[model samples]
Each structure stands twice: as structure tokens, then as C-alpha cells.
Target: MSSSNKIQKKTKSIDATKKLAEKIKKQALLKQKELQKSSNQDADADADNSTTHTALSKATSTSPVSSTVDPDAQLKFNTFAELKLVPDLLEAIQQLKYTKPTPIQSEAIPYALEGKDIIGLAVTGSGKTAAFAIPILQSLWHAQTPYFGLILAPTRELAFQIKETFDALGSTMGLRSVCIVGGMDMMDQARDLMRKPHIIVATPGRIMDHLEHTKGFNLKNMKYLVMDEADRLLDMDFGPVLDKILKVIPAKRTTYLFSATMTNKIEKLQRASLNNPVKVSVSTKYQTADNLIQSMMLVNDGYKNTILIHLLNEFMGKSTIVFTRTVAHAQRTALLARILGFNAVPLHGQLSQAQRLGSLNKFKSGTVNILVATDVAARGLDIPSVDLVINYDVPTDSKSYIHRVGRTARAGRSGKSISLITQYDLEMYLRIEQALDKKLPKEDKPAREILDALHIHVDKATAEAIRQTKEIHDKRGNGRRRKNYDDDREEK
Candidate 1:
């Protein structure tokens, strides 16, 4: 054929390819629209109004419910009974005393059970673990497979918490879950893996370590991949580790990505991890829960400690989490609270894994009612007993503020959060308010009167707490240096 004839043929082939591409895009969009419409329909029929739930108002005096119900009111699930969950799981839910589903659970569980990819955007303490755990358990109830699901979390504590949830919900089914995280015994984790467990709850780095080194262990047959607290995972610089896991996992598996906030990194992760996902965003705005009563108290430059002490005394015997900006601050504040006769514990990255877990367990078990910590405990662990969260130190940003306050007001429970703001925290406080799109309520009581009621004296207790904090800090620093020296010598 002539050159002109060949050119005409190539151009016609190009046109055909373009037409096919357009058709595929149109089909995908239509499918998305259909899924969205169905989701809207689900929302219309099954939605639960958590803000107005009786559970949240049992003790508050004449608490008024929001007059406006979301237009998607029909999509909420009022109770666990309405979810069509398996009988065993429902029994477990009842045993756990979960009468109603939080918004995230109400919305995400249905789609997850259908084996669709999902991106659940909810605040911390929004019952996201159950949203994924229920469906995974329901799928694995009768599966003879060794590992049916893989749930990834940013921190070991979060991973362990997920594992506990899985164990509780699947207890009747005799299902098992193995936790893979750093700082734990690798051989023990390997032994657990050898048991042919049905679920694997792990952190990204440790999971990669096991996948690369552990013999005869793989997730090739895994059916579901869940990245809980996905935003914090990426923010912690686990992107490369996540990529490695994705490459090894089966391409046919369903995925559920849950996060408290959305960022550029989270969006990219969603694109890389999910396929045709249904986005379930219960919290589009960077705001705390409707059940959370947030307030801020302005303090003089040197009076934050005094205010914090007063507040802790005011909320004595209640489950409270006190967030400090630094590990040293957490330690000092916790020691001070202890000296003040409050049952307090400290949680920070500086502690050993066992100690961190022990601290958390103590807080959860009510052995210790006050938990002092840095941002490490801010994101994903749910403690329903936390009725109050005191920002001993104001958060550095809006995202931190959201997560910090989220430690309370969990699972549709009414809770209160107060931030101690000084002149230095004013700028960050303003940014937080702007991010939340509303001004926090100011404390109604006068500062002098509040302090007078508490009658706190900081002379001896404060000095001793500061001294204890310094001693602990020095020991940790020295231990780290010793480890480094030992490692260097071994390499030689």
C-alpha cells in the first residue's frame, strides 16, 4: 500500500481507541453515580441520630437536641439489630452493651459487608474499628483460611486495640487474630502466624519486616485490607512501607481506608490502595463531635498549671485524658496530678511497648482515671470511659486539636473538652477555631473564683513532680545512648 493509505489507517485506529476510552470513562462515572444513589437511599432509610440518642442525654439536664436532622436521616442505622449482622456478632455486640451504631459504623458497615472498597472519614472515637471488624468477622465466620484479613494501623497500640476488637467480636466463632508490631517478640509473632490465624492486625513497618523475613508466611490469600487511621499512618512517614505491602497483597482483595482527617497524602494513599471506593465521610469538616462540649479558658502566662490542677480536681473520679505537647510535660503533669491525689498515668513514645500498653490498660480498666500523654494517644484508640479531655497544653494545629478533643465524646457518648490557653497559645488557638469554623465557648466562671474553689497549692508537689520528670527523661536518654553504643560495638 502507499504511504498515504498507511497514514489514513493509523489515524482511524487512533480514533477508535479514543472512542473506547471515552466509553469506559462514561461507564465508570455512571457506576459511581449508581453507587452514590444507592448509598443515599441507604442513608435515608437506616440513619441514626447520634446527637439525639438517649444514651448521650441520660445525665445531662434538659439537654436540647439539635432541631435540624440531616437530610440523609433515612440512611442511618438506629441500632445494631438493624444491621443484618450475624447472630453471634449481634450477641457479642449486645454483650458489649452497644445498643446503637455510631454514624461511621452505621454507614460503613453496610458497604464493607458488600465487599466494596470504602474510605471512611470519621473523627477519632467514632467506632471505626467495628465498622471494618464486623464485616471482616462476618466474612471469616466459616472460612477455613489461615489469614482472611489484614488490618494496618499507625502505632502498635492502635494495632493491638484492633486485634482486641476482632477477638471480642469473633470470639463466638473461635476466630483468632495475630498482632504484628515493632518492639514485640518477633519469634512470638512468628509463632502466632504459624497458628494459621484468621486475621492479622499489624503496623506497616513490622508487617513488612515479617513479610520479608518470616518463612512460609504470606498474605497472598488475604481477602480484605484495612488501613485504619490511614492519615496518621501516612503522616508518620509509612508511605514506602505501605507501598511494599500493596505490591505483595492480592489485587483482587477489597480495601477499607479509615481516617480522622483528609490530607494530600491520604488522598494519594486512597488512590493507590482502593479501587472504585465509596467514600463515607461522617466528618467532612475538621470539627469535634456534636456530643462534645468544647470550651477554652484563658490563663495568665504562669497560671496554666494552676488552671489545670483546678480542672483536674473539678473532674475528679471521672475518666479523663490530659494531652501535653511534649513527653517531659506529660511526665511532669502526670506526676503532679498523682501528687494531687488523682489516679494518673502517663503514655508517651518514650516508654517501652509494655509500659505504654500497661499505662493504657490501666486507664481503660479504671485503675487510673487520668491519662497524661503527648499526641501519640490522640488519634485512634477508643476509651468510652473518657468523659473529659483536658488539653493541658493547647495543640499545635487544628488537626491535633480535633484528634485531642476526639479522645472524649466517643461512640455517641456525651463528653466535655477544655483547652488551657495562655498568651503563647493564642495564635494556635485562633487557627484551631478557624479550622473548626466556630469559636469555642469561654469558661463561664471567673478565674479567681475557680481557683478559690479548688484551693490548690503548688509549693512542694510541683517541685517534686518536676524533679521526677527530669530524672525519668535523663534515664531514657542515657538508655538510648547505651543501646546505640552497644549496637556500634557489635557492628565493629
Candidate 2:
């Protein structure tokens, strides 16, 4: 072709792309307006007009139900029984006391049951697991086959949580599911695979290991594939691994990809994985649940710990999660809390698999009311009773901030999140506010005498925590060195 012709063709292609982009933008705006109108109607009908105040001065609040319900299909069906679910599944849901479906479930379940690929966009704790699991289980009831579905999660805790949901929902149906993730016994997982369970919930890396090494454990016949927390999965650099998995799974399978936000990366993955998928998005942008009371405290760097202790004491007897940026900080904070006479536990990646699960169990069972954790516990682990979330360190990004605070105010429950902002965190905190499109209310500072009194106990606890942490590190180092020395001596 002539050079002029080539230039004309390129210009035409660019114009076409611009038109498509504009079309999508217009559609999104329409959806946003519709959702907003519906929310207003619901609020007018069922909202409580009372005000509640806590130790913190009057904080901003909204109706919890308004934030979670998507008017699409939700107004049509009010209960699980109205959704035309199978009798056995309906019985299980009723027994579990799940009366209503959240917006995600209300919208996605119908399309999923129709055997179409889906792209679900909702914040964390919006009942996404059941949205996908119900359709898969309903289909499995008709066709009982092993290795029928594969669910991938960004973290091990989320993968296990998804498996728990499957087990609970499918209890009456004799459904079999297995969770495969890193930091566990591969040989044991291999043995479980030998049993040929119906569903496999796993993190990307470990499942890839099994696919490569475990004989007779291929997803050749898998019918349903779910990528939960798809953005986080790719953010953790699982793109290449996911590409390989996609190539191996059958092309005709139903795929459901769920995420809190849609970046360029998520868009690309959606195109590559889902086939003509129906998109169901209940949230507009980076948004927290309306029931979540968010506030921040600007503190001096030296007084962050003292202020954190003060907040914890004020919220005593409430189930809480204290989020830190680093594993070391999480460990130290939990140690400090315990020393100060609070029942606390730490959850982070550095602990063994058993230890991590133990920490989660303790917090869930109310054996410990406070859990100090890194972002590992942020995304999709649902403990519905979580009443408070404390950001001991401001998250580096807005997305992490959304997930960290999402730990509370789940499933239409009222909860609170407080971010402890220091001088160094001001810039990042501002960025988070920009993303949320709203300013968080500044928490009233406690009396100076209150902090001064707590400082004495905090100082002693901090010193003791540092000493204990150092001793633990030394013991681990000595154990490693001793093993190496013994190996060398044996070789000699």
C-alpha cells in the first residue's frame, strides 16, 4: 500500500478506538446514576434516623444497607427463597441463616447460573464468594465430577476462606473441596489431590507447582474457573503464572473474575480470560462501606504507639484488627499490646502456616479480641464480628487503604476504622483521601495528660518487646547455624 493509504488507515483506527472509549465512559456514568437513584429510594424507605456517638466525637455515618445493595435485580428478589434456588441449596442457605443476598450475589448469581462468563466489581466483604460458589454448586448437583472447578486467590488466607464457604454452602450436597496454597505440606496436598475433590481453592504459585509435578492432577476437564481478587493476584506478579494456567484449562469453561478496582492490568486480564462476559459493578470508585466510620489522627512520630494504646483501651472488649506496614511492626505491636494486658495475637507471612491459622482462629473465636497484622489479612478473610480496624501505619496506596479498612463494617454491620497519621505519612494520607474523593474526619485528640500517663507503661512495654523479639530472632538464627554445622560435620 502507498504511504498515504497507510496513514489514512492508522487515523481511522485511532478514531474508532476513541469512539469505543467514549461509549464505555457514557455507559459507566449511566450505571452510576441508576445505582445512586436506587440507593436514595432504599434509604427513604428503611433507613434509621438515629445518631450514635462514641468516645471519638460525633463521626460521619451512613446507612449500612445503602452501601451494599445494588438495585439491579435486588429489588426483584428480596430473599434467597425468591431467587428460585434449588431446594437442597435453599435448605442449606436457610439453615446457615443467610436470608438475603448481597448486591454482588443478587446481580452475578443469575448471570452465572445462565452459564455466562462474569466480571464482578465490588468492594471486599460484599459476599462475592457466594456469588460464584452457588452457581458452581448448583451445576455440580446435576453433574457430580471430581476436579470440576478451580478457584484462585491472591493470598493463602483468602483461598482457605473461599474453601470454607464452599464447604458450608455445600454441606447438604456432600460436596468435596480442597484448599491448596504455599506454606503447607505439598505431599499432603498431593495426597488430597489423589482423592480427586470437586473444587480446588488455591493461590496461583502453589497450584502451578501441583500442575507441573503432580501426576494425574490436571484441570483438563475443569468446567468452572474463578479468579478472586484478580487485581491483587496480578499485582503480586502472578500474571505469567496465570497465563500458563489459562492455556492449560479448557477454553469453554465459565470464568468469573472479581476485584475491588479495575486497572489497565485487570482490563487486560478480563479480556484474555473471560469470553463475552457480563460486567456487574456495584461500586463507583474507591469507596468504603457507608456503615464504616473512618477517622484519622495526626500524631507526632514519637507518640504513635502511645496514641494507639489509648485508642485500644477506649475500644476495649471490641474485636479489632491493628494493621501495620511491616511484619516486624506487627510482631512488635502485638507483643506490646499483650504486655499492656490486652489479649492480642499477630498474623503475618513470617510465621509458619500452623501459627498463622492459629492466630486467625483465636481472633475469630474471641479468645483474643485484638489482631495485629500486616496487609496479608486485609483482602478477603471475613470475620463478621470485627468491630474496629486501626491503621497503625498509613497505607502506601489508596487501594491498600480501602482493603485495610474493609476488614470491618462487613455484611451491613456497623464498624469503625482509624488511621494513625504521622508527619511522614501526611503526603500518602492526602493521596488516599484524594482517591476516596472525601476527606476523613480528623479525630479529636485525647487529653495530653492521658497520653502522658500511658507513656510510662508503653515505654516499659516497648523495651520488653524489643528484648523478647531480639531473643526470638537469635534463637532462630542459632537453630539455622546449628543445622548447617551438623550437616558439615556429618559430611566430613
Number of the top-ranking candidate, with TM-score as the measure: 2
User: Could you estimate the TM-score for every candidate?
Assistant: 0.80, 0.83
Q: lDDT per residue, candidate 2, 1-492, as tens digits?
A: 999999999999999999999999999999999999999987865544432234223454322112234634435456888767778888899888988888888877878888988888887788999989999999999989999999999887888899999999999999999999877788999999999999999888788889999988899999999999888887776878899999999998999988877677877887788776888888866988988999999999898899999999999999999999987899899999999999999997767667889999999999999999999898989999999999999989999999999999999999999999999999999999999988999999899998999898898999999888777657768665465333222111
Q: Which residue pairs collide in model 2, if any?
A: none
Which digits, one per residue and each the tens of the lDDT, describe model 1 over residues 1-492? Answer: 999999999999999999999999999999999999999987766545544565556645442111222424654678888877789988998898878777777777777877788888877787889888888888887565778999998877788899999888887778878888877788999999989888999888778888999999999999999988887778766777788889999999989888889788876876687776878876665967888999998887566777788777778788999999987799898999889888999997777778899999999999899999988898788787789999988988889889888888876689999888888999999999998889999985456876655544654678889998888777768777465333222111
TM-score of 1: 0.80
Error of 1 at 351 (Å): 0.9
Off by over 4 Å in 1: 1-72, 76-84, 444-456, 481-492
In candidate 1 the C-alpha lDDT for residue 249 amounts to: 97
TM-score for model 2? 0.83
Prediction 1 global C-alpha lDDT: 0.82
> How much RMSD separates candidate 1 from the native structure?
16.3
Q: What is the lDDT of residue 204 in candidate 1?
A: 83
